[model samples]
Target: MIKPTLDEEKKETKFSKKYWKYDGLHVISFTKAGLREENQDGISIEFELNDKLKESDDRLKGYYLFGVYDGHGEHGDKISDDCVEHLSKYIAKRLYELPIVENEKEIKNAIKKGFDDTENYFKTHDINGIKGNKVRMSGTTALTVMMTPKKNLYIAFVGDSSVFFMSSNKSKKINIEHNCHNQNELLRLRALRQKGFMYSIKARSGRKYLRVKDDLSNEIQYTRSFSDFYIKNFFSGGLIAEPEIIDKVYSAFNLDLLVLASDGITDRSKIFNKHPTEIYLSYLKRYKGDPNRFVKACDEMIKLCDSITEKRICVDDMSIIIIIILNGKSEDEWCHIVTKNAEDPEDWDNTTHEDELSDIDDQDIYNQNSNEVDDFLVSVPLSTIPIEYYDEDSAMNFTISDDDNFD
Candidate 1:
């Protein structure tokens, strides 16, 4: 069956972003159930921006927010299987409390804390046979983006999921992959693969303990997934479980739009060998870079996979989130303010805090080039689409249109 990717859903929703010099948004789309039988995936997404800011400060006014909850392979279905429920709701609730710090470190700490809290909650209320088991392997991944006018723009990933920043200057993978089997991940896993045991006390009242196992061959390689019962001990439920994450925040960094998605985009990444970040940039112009169009393209690709595999190999759950950054400020007013400065420059300009953080140059990244991906390949596509999948004209009555030019 033909399934939707994170990008596809974005095509359905559109929000304006002209108010703020900087803006941010949030979205959390969840997974659908019974995919294994129907051979389809389910998803739900929510997008919102800083509505309150419109009164507090003109520059900090209305913006857009969108989130994604994409499940794939077995992961998406498992969420409905009760592997990762309510977690999506919980995250959406938390993001409603925004105007999050304009500072990068503060933003990072906030996200870290949120994730930690989610894990702690999951540990306490373990799912059915899904926690503390010795052989469970169920988990979910998350991709997120935070942007502010002329402030900081940051994107992060903790699994195979990804978020892309598409703009004129550059299009790149701001989010890092944290899959356990990634080369770097494998090396670290090997180190943690086997070991002995130890214990240490922080002080008179604090204590800690450690236990190490042997290498993969000698030890049990449950990396694929821990038992359903012990899932708690292995992966923190509600976590985007992968490897060490890659994060960045820029002072002058800004974007017209943010694309957050799961591994389904990675499929596109594979075809282009283009990093998820670059996919938007490369195709933005070609696809009018509209979120819906981008996703429709991805959905079409999913169908392509189905055609190739004849519905057998890699049928996966897909999801995406598209955030159009809008300052929700008066266009005429901002023009006056910016133009006022243009006519007469001043060191005391209060427009923004540019260069408030380290300026890191875009690197000659060590990424798997899309062109080079063809050299190492095997193909098995499994995207079967029943006729009924598209029978619905519009799930949300979003005023369909074919006009692609929106920039």
Candidate 2:
């Protein structure tokens, strides 16, 4: 138990909530760690939630799982805590109720509904004392993955939290992050700012601000025209909509490993280390199949990722879940294939980075040809506090199939 001294007595925290789920085929374990740093701006809290799901009973049902949830804010702890728990329980409960089948569309709807409902649930509840009841509001970004034996896998996202999949064919990355950074989103932010609307916080590297992010412009835009926080921070990852599909079907792509994480771990390939999964896996291959060692390796990697002197979240509460598909291609196979096919123009541009792609996301690999076009339009969009269009009409915000599979 944690006790408070006289100075801390007045600011004691007495709140806790939890949720978990594991099937007969896999053993999923998660560990959380965080850092609180003092800054001139204010107190910023950065934390990471990690997960490892392994096939427990084996029996062909076991597979390993990896995931991370990094949220910012001193009081957003409740939101982060709630998001992880809600995410796990929501996915488990919905999957448990679904019929055994490879209906990718059904799986999509299940996840979409889970997020939509979760957001609605929070909106309807009276979160009076949850965060602090004084900081205007408190919440968190949601990033998660679910791997199943039916030769399936799925992921959901709310913010910049990302995923990377590795396979012999290729490695894949996705911007499931539906924020103001998308092509249209950037234009919108600019229009809004030009119209006199934008978050007030300055964009900085080390400081964690409640302000929204504009992809085109690192800092939130400012103009004298349209100023709608609801529209400015317009997209949400929490319980609003189904996380944009990073990869819709994992098995279809023949993925070998996956890495799900928050932006803090390795943000901007141009900045921090470009690939931690590759780095960790390089040293971890010899210890495959052991949960204890696997977990230890993960924790150690996180510590190495963090730096106490770093102003920002060193590896910022980094969380990473690595899933190793039993028969998936090995790193050597992938490297050999890449080198062999490097000059194969016909295959190079279209290569899905199979080994890396599958585990990173549940992307619709078959639609890779189409997604390439989307890559051009890729941008991050943000959502406002009480989403501008959040109401009875919000249902229309999602143009999902009534019969998701029918279409």
State the lDDT of candidate 1 residue by residue for 113-183, as single tens digits: 54555444544555555444311333444544544444455454445556666444455555444432244
The TM-score that candidate 1 achieves is: 0.49
RMSD, every candidate, angstroms: 18.5, 14.4
Residue-level lDDT of model 2, residues 212-298, one tens digit each, is 222322232211101111332442211123356555465624665566655444332213223545544543443344544344445
Say which candidate scores most in lDDT: 2
Which of the numbered candidates is closest to the native, going by highest TM-score? 2
Candidate 2's displacement at residue 307, Å, is: 3.6
- Per-residue error at 383 for model 2, in Å? 27
Q: What is the TM-score of each candidate against the true structure?
A: 0.49, 0.54
Counted clashes in each candidate structure: 48, 60
The superposed Cα distance between candidate 2 and the true structure at residue 224, in angstroms, equals: 24
As a TM-score, model 2 comes out at: 0.54
